[model samples]
Target chain A: MNKKWMSITVSLVLVFTLLATACSNKEKNSGGSTAKEGGKGEQVTITHYTIDSPDRTFVEKLIPDFEAKHPNIKVKVTKAPYEQFDSKLQSSIAAKNAPDVTSHWGYGGFMEYYNKEMLLDLTPYLDGFSGSDYNIPEDVMNIYKVDGKTYGIPLNSYVTVMLYNKDLFDKAGLSYPPTDYEDKSWTFDKMVEYAQKMTVDSKNLEEAQYGVDFGFGERDQRPQYFGAHVYSDDTWSNGGKPSEINLTKLEVVDAYKTIYGLIYDKKISPTPAFSQTVSGQYGDPFLSGKIGMSVVGSWSLAAAADFSFNVGVAAVPYNPNGDVRSVLYVDPLFVLKDSKHPKEAMEWIKYLITTEIQEKSIELSGGNPPVNQAAAEKYYNNFEGIEPKGIQQVFDGAYKYGFESYNHLISNYSQINELFINELAGVENGDKQVENVLPDIEKKLKDLLARVNK
Target chain B: MREAALKESANEVRRMRKWKLSQIIGFVILLLVTITMLSPVWFMVTTSLKTTKEMLVFPPTLIPKVFAWGNFSELFTNTDIKFGQQYRNSLIVSIFTVIGTIISSSFVAFGFARYQARSSSFLFMLVLSTLMLPYPAIMIPQFLLFMNLGLHDSLLPLILPSFFGSAYMIFLLKQFFSTLPDELYNAGRIDGCSEFRLYWNLTLPLAGPALATVAIFSFIWSWNDLLTPVLYLDSQENFTLPVGMAAMLSSKFRLAPWNLLMAASILSVLPIMLLFAVAQKRFVEGIVLTGIK
Candidate 1:
């Protein structure tokens, strides 16, 4: 009898505990859904997932305004760190709870999402607004197009340029690199000459004041100067042989040799060793006043504006033979196919690209160069003190000369990048010649391509 | 005899000197290792107090020239990041996890330890095999299950899982329960005490160290867990500290504010450190008791 009573008591307690847990969970669900259905006539909450950054602040600031303007819609922004955003976004999509709109880069993962039919075809919405209303150039819009259908609206575009410290140039008694894109004198050889002069303690290279910091490995930037494409054909045809490894080409070899000279022969740039120690310690060697010049993206403008010394912006130095080409990084906003409110999401995206929002972005965040032409012009022309002179060149270079390499589109980019770096590591450390390693690297890359393509 | 005594004294002095020398060497080595281990923590604290400009300087300053204590204040006061609310959420989740894991795990462990069904060993092995299944393999399935149950976005997804005893914890507690004498249980049964009372009284009272061990592990695991919280919780008000700190480090437009990040990191780690310090004795005893028995 005692045992039976004890068993009954235990079962009752367990039942109550489970009931309590379930009730609490149900309460939370009801609470959230009720708020969504509250006062302003059936509010629709649109979730926006983006990276947590100062740019997020702009979104947060604009949400209230957006909500006030569109009384029925409430924008909920969830931000994760940049590193975790991709994985989280993938998991969320898999879980069938992806945000209505998301910020994505114009390359690799975006292409994957588009291929998977996860992203909405934004073409129908594009028809609502005229081309002139968007103000983004045709070529810029082409970046977000897959199979001749647009999937994303580019929020901003950034291009790499030679950012030099004018104070360093003056101290070195050298003329500034030309800002004009067509300047014949602003070639790779001329930049190298200037780098040599600007570099201090060329003999004791380890402790030397560097003339230029590429901000990344030489393989990424130096190849661009020589117009060395990673693939024989630069077109991206899905699952087709549009990609064939072309690392063994004479032009590509020459590009590698020139980069090798910059690191080992000229000693104008910091060695990989010096970079390992001081790169993060002194943020952006150019901004830290440690290097005379740096090849950096438009994102560096905010840091440049805060530099203690005067800064100068110029077109990236090109090879005399190669056409002027700057690497452009475009960030685009995409609406998910599973989004409950695609029309509303598109409206928000259109609002983001407007001149008013772009201008506010400039005032609040020292915004990225607006994709809208009028806004870009206003941003550069009205830009005041500390914005490095010749800010217009960034826009000019991007519009006229910007080219995104096949590297960004390739799924095996990190692997290919690793192959190049591993082969060049010996040359970078001054132990091997570029000529000796090029053929070996080309063989390995071809094998990798065959395997990856298979 | 006097000469012998003097010689013995000299030998004793020599031995003492040698002993002192070895002791000094050991102390020096230990001190060096401790310093090396503690340097990163020291750097984090100092870096938190540094200005953005100072943080970027090469061969980083061990001491900040301008101590920006405002980093802490800024972290607390940031409107976008509800640090206080997230801290509270973490505490709630961790507390429930600890209680649920202890109660459920001990209950399951007592059954496995005392019961003698025909397939008991096979069943035990089956429970143990779950430990081999990695979290990722079952993550999606578990997520779908929770979603079907309408528990997807709530803290219940994190909390309710703990109520079903974990394989590792159950294995640990079962081992601990087996070490106890059966006489206690038999004696309680003779006194007309039921199986439930016997477990509630005789076993649970004697399982203090084991329960403490389980509690500490559960608390720390739940507290530090990033993936589960990130998966389940979407709202900022419900976010855990790890996820919030990760968000702090990855900025899309501007450079990450390292000082504020470090300050938040330090604050997040403080609770775990305090918990460990408080329950350290029982934790160690539990491990030793389980290991030998």
Candidate 2:
């Protein structure tokens, strides 16, 4: 071999060897024992996977505090986008490198993880932790439990309510919609008629303002609204077993028709084309005083608050026959079964749920509407400029009726969400009518359930 | 009337002659197309400067209402997402990956391109076939392998596999190697240069454009990759920019601060875009060297 060529070959191999050694060094040091104090001080690293990005100031703060409190136990955190969280989580589970703890979305998601045998049962630890005393509703906790075995803790809870423009109400010479706190006279039809009355089109049909603004393209919001209505109002059977979910009931169909009519008969919503031109403009349309009312959540309460206009809050309109009031959704945190440090992870979860952290986190996040009843009492009951009026009253009325994603009941929820979207898109297309659409959906949902059950 | 018509026709001819109108028109069209293609990137850069309220304004403003230098400031202020650390992680991973990919792929490509062995062809085909397998199917198995190897969460999970060379890169390099005269290699053998020596000196140096092509491809792929980092890295300190950016989006109940996200995104892509611009000549030459046409 030529001396020059031989030297170059030797140098390449040398570089390759150096790289390999460096990589090996990195692997060796990447993880170390994060041994707990009370347990064997043999290093025990608690790897927590959450959907929270490293960028969120809250998480940046939370991790340091967590690490500081448990200096002996190393807390490692990984984050992924919400869109890919479930898939990435499932992959982690299958790989058995599943994190010791994870933050997951609401009960529907919590239930899926529970069924998969992927979550660590927290029942043994709950005895030491007084979770029930925290004023998180009994029903909310029940959502995280399966067969009376708790699987996770609520990290944050969100609920949907009727958000109204108070300024628009005043202009129309009408009072804010009432909840049980004032009087119980408000009914579903009355709410609809009021929305219709409040709707003001300009001098031309082309310039007409919408009465109510609703999220149209996204079908996920539909379930949050309808699920509450179905649970409270419908009565039927899941085969031989008795069930309250009967969409076939006249009153139930009427409720569906009434909600559907807002789009078709009223033409109050932005057309699909216009809405698509500017997505998520429901907030803009409502806040700009172009729409009189909207059925939005406390998550959107801050949007109205940011507006230079007046706004009010009310319970989600109730059905007098069913008498259902508010609908609630909560996002929770769960411990994975394959967690390397389940005990330490549970302690972290416990710390997060404490009244102190929950209150402070909620206050920092601007009106998360605390799950803890006592912490909630600390907030002003009647703040004039907070956008949504009687925020606490809405919180009080919230627990009366709650619903979760129908997809959560079944394992293949993504497929069901796709089916729901396509079916609703058809309704939006005006090809398959809403009345015609439900039975096909009902059959598909039942078929999905049977396959899963089998 | 005939005089008037003749005057108008002469005026038209004069107008065409003075402007060289078609060429200028064509150049203008090309310029417009280029600007149109680049507008989205320009928008991303501009939006990074916008305040949160400005980003969500109705009829979306083309320019920032207020420049939020704070977004860039916040990126560095946090210990959780040390922007410098993420950039270093990405750089370290990409540099190592590029070197590994080049060495491994060239070695593998030499066997395919120069050797007459029967199994060489078979092995090359086998490598090509791996591209067809859906990634998610083997995702669990790959994760377990890394876990068993105790490489999970470290740069090894992201880096070590590149040492084996990628099928696509090998194919690219092999195509270029094949186009080179066989006599040059024969001449190397006559000089008593071993197979390794031939590859190390004459072949690789001559294939500089192709090597640069593979290196740039490997660097960009490694830099922008989110899924691998998300799957492997288990600490904030370990996160690359993409994984860190994703976490930022989901962290709060309120929508992610668009200003911060856009600023971070722009910063994340700047190095890569700048690299592409700097390497444009070599990249294009490398593409042509591969004889992709």
Point out the worst 10-residue segment of candidate 1 chain B by lDDT: B247-256
* Runs in model 1 lying further than 4 Å from the true structure: A1-43, A105-108, A166-171, A198-208, A216-222, A237-241, A271-273, A279-289, A305-310, A381-389, A405-408, A411-454, B291-293
Cα deviation of A384, candidate 1, in Å: 6.9
Docking class of 1: acceptable
Q: Give one digit per residue, the lDDT tens place, for model 1 in A9-72.
A: 5885576477557635653331111235666466677778777666554577888888888787
Please, what are the lDDT tens digits per residue for candidate 2 over residues A207-316? 45566765421253253344323333211112111132344455545655656677677765544544444434222455445566776656666454455467777767
Per-residue lDDT for A369 in model 2?
Answer: 57
Worst 10-residue lDDT window for candidate 1 chain A reads A26-35
Report the Cα lDDT for residue A112, model 2: 53
Interface RMSD of each: 4.6, 4.5
Interface RMSD of 1: 4.6
Alpha-carbon error at A230 in model 2, in Å? Answer: 7.0
- Compared with the true structure, all predictions reach lDDT values of 0.74, 0.66
TM-score for each candidate, following the candidate numbering: 0.88, 0.83
